[model samples]
Target: MAGVRKGGDLEEVEIDLGDASDPEDLDEGEQPETLWKASSDREGESIHSSSLVDISDTKPLINVRDPRGMNDCLKVTFEDVIAEPVSVRSGDRVWIWSHALFEVSRIWVYRIVTVLLAIPMSILSGILFAVLSCIHIWMISPCIKCILIGTRWLQKLWDVVLEVIVRPLLTSAGRCCGGFNIHLAEE
Candidate 1:
């Protein structure tokens, strides 16, 4: 109790690491209780804000040669707040575990796109059917019937061959090969 105080608050935590001349010289009273300790008031205190008191008359953040180290952490920021950010769903749908499966506009736009693409494609198909019928035909009546049946048969054969040979090796091998062996490829 020669230099120890009873009521005065601890203004600074003095770390005398280099003062230990011998390992046996460290008595029970001389050793600190904790291995690593820091004042809680250093929270959010910028290193540039505090200045030196001796030369500059302020508590400056100096890069000491003895304790040469620095620690930094990752900081994620959105808009203005400094904390965890929330991801907003931009669609009207049921979001399940960060994934929205029942998208309203997704299916709607898909249907709309299919209809849009189908309109032009179906019109072209119809025109192609008419033009093919007109080819290699002298008689109008019989030729029209033949063209209709021929076109239908050709389309069926093409669909079969495409599904069996082309599609099995290309787009949908699983579905194409599944019903192909039983001669049930939508004749």
Candidate 2:
């Protein structure tokens, strides 16, 4: 879709093409000529104009005289322009620039609205996220670290208790139960 905006106020227009005959059945080297019609609303009334032209022909549609092998369909020669602004009023008839036409006012409106809302909303969300992150780092992080340090100290105390008290008791019990047989005899 294409749009032409002149000032702060945006005016939208649309073009709708009716079902036309397909040119696929034509034989090789044959091009199909189509009756093209274009219409617009003027003062709440329909105004239409039509022309007979070959729709399937791929030859340059804009320039018919140039033989320089430039097949560009939209080659503009500045010489063709009048260089003066032609006065056109609302409801006045205007010629269609090309055979093809399109419009996208609704999509354009949605896009602009999304962009407008996104800027402020993103800033607010970013500020909220930063505040939460600071709280987690400054307040919650030190508390978690202290808990981790306490757990490590407890683990070291448990190891020391096991080594000093439990290991000797287990060894003496094993000796009394004949678990180890070591004897010295002077024979």
Query: Where in model 1 is the C-alpha error above 4 Å?
Result: 1-106, 136-187
lDDT score for candidate 1 against the true structure: 0.52
Tell me the TM-score of model 1: 0.20
TM-score, every prediction: 0.20, 0.27
Worst 10 residues of 1 by lDDT: 74-83
Which residue pairs in candidate 2 have backbone atoms (N, alpha carbon, C) closer than 3 angstroms, thus clashing? none
Q: How well does candidate 2 score on lDDT at residue 127? A: 100
lDDT of 1 by residue, 1-187 (tens): 1333346443444333343335476676675333223332334433233332232212244534234344223221222332233575433343342233334455677789988898899899999988877763546778788888879978899899988899757766666766665445765
Best candidate according to lDDT: 2
Tens-digit lDDT string for candidate 2 (14-42) = 32243333457767777444435333333
Candidate 2: Cα lDDT at 109: 65
RMSD of 2: 29.2
